[model samples]
Target: MTDTTQPNTATDARPPAAPRRRRRGGAKTSPDARVAPPPQPGARPPRKPSPVLERLFALYPRLFGARFVPLKLGVYEDLLARHPEDFSPEELKLAMGQHARSTRYLESVAAGHPRHDLDGNAVAPVAPEHVHHAILELHRRRHPRTPADAQAGLNARLVARVARAIEASGLPHHDYAARVRSRDASANAVVDEALITLAAQAAKREALLRAFEASGRGEPEFAEMYGIPLDEVRRSLQQARAARTPAT
Candidate 1:
């Protein structure tokens, strides 16, 4: 006789399943459950490089073959924007051409390897800043600001420097008078000697201005190197301005 109440053998064969564990702090979550986090505000989407930039990159190596250096296209773009359309293209070409022909740039190209130009002549590469400066030179040349104008500006700076130096040097009249009295020299002799010393100092100051300008050093660097105070530099610049002013 068949037992009607007997459990199925297939159901009894499998072992009991383990209970799911919960997080120690947070609420329990299913393995399949997911929480999508909020998106970041003002997140920029990926940008495609501009066609002009891509073209420039493509032509760069060919233009300055064996000496191409990667640079930001935005810098040239800004320059191109500010420039007059009539000369912009020509200026860019000129700058790039100069870079290609520069011996310094060519040497850098072959820094560690045997790099040669199309005609098999070795060449150097330059930094983007060099090219940028070349572009600036073109603009400056076009503008033609006179050397005297430049000198005038620098001289104003020079006067400021001189004033600061004078302050640091103390009162020249008092100093000279004390020395003259100590030596029992005539007052007229002291005045003459002071005049000669003043003339020499003026020459030295001019020389210093030339040196600083030639070296391309700013005020801070010049002051630090020569032990002159910044205030003195400003004073010298002011004195130069006064000297240059028209007698009105």
Candidate 2:
């Protein structure tokens, strides 16, 4: 008899496989995922400020702000001690170097301001030699196009700055010269000129003091006799006395 069972010609009885659900987060990414497009040609990427500097700014805005102040000599140690976890020694050193060498910091140093701590408290006076160097460096930065020969001759402004720095130091002329002497003959020549200027000023002040003492005149009388302002005469006398006083 012909079997009633029809040949099972129907397609496989299993239901169609479910479409793969997309990953919850999206398509799977590979290790070689595409990165952001590179910066356009000739277009520079914005530079991010050093992380260490950012941390320092957060901690001591006053010390690291636009109007920077001279930092105490041991500020590096102080920072490390206070924020051991926030900074690595090498990066901290690099940031500090950059900060110290910045034009703003040099300006603060050149202005004869006292060094300050993180708390903004004045800690000590910046050394006169440091001030002198800052002034020179600032001049060099500003006058990059100045001829080396002309620079060697030393400009009037630089000469005056040198004189002021050494005079403010309250050090003997020889001592000051010895401290700042370098192999640069031009710099030495400038220093010599400054010494001469300081010497003349010293002599004038000494003579004025002597005359005032001999005349037994009060500051006002002495100022009148010399046709100088009373404040000027007093300031000159005080400065001379301070110069004579030994540094502790």
lDDT of 1: 0.48
How do the residues 1-248 of candidate 2 rate in per-residue lDDT, one tens digit apiece?
77656553465455679999898987888878957788899998887888888888888889886679999988999999989999889999999998898888999999899999878999899987788789878987986644555665667888898998987787777988998888877678889999888888878888888888899878888789889999889988987787677778
Where does candidate 2 stray beyond 4 Å?
Answer: 1-48, 145-152, 210-218, 238-248
lDDT, candidate 2, equals: 0.85
Error of 2 at 72 (Å): 2.3
RMSD of 1: 21.1
**Which regions in candidate 1 have their CA more than 4 angstroms from the true location?**
1-185, 240-248
lDDT of each: 0.48, 0.85
Candidate 1, backbone clash total: 22
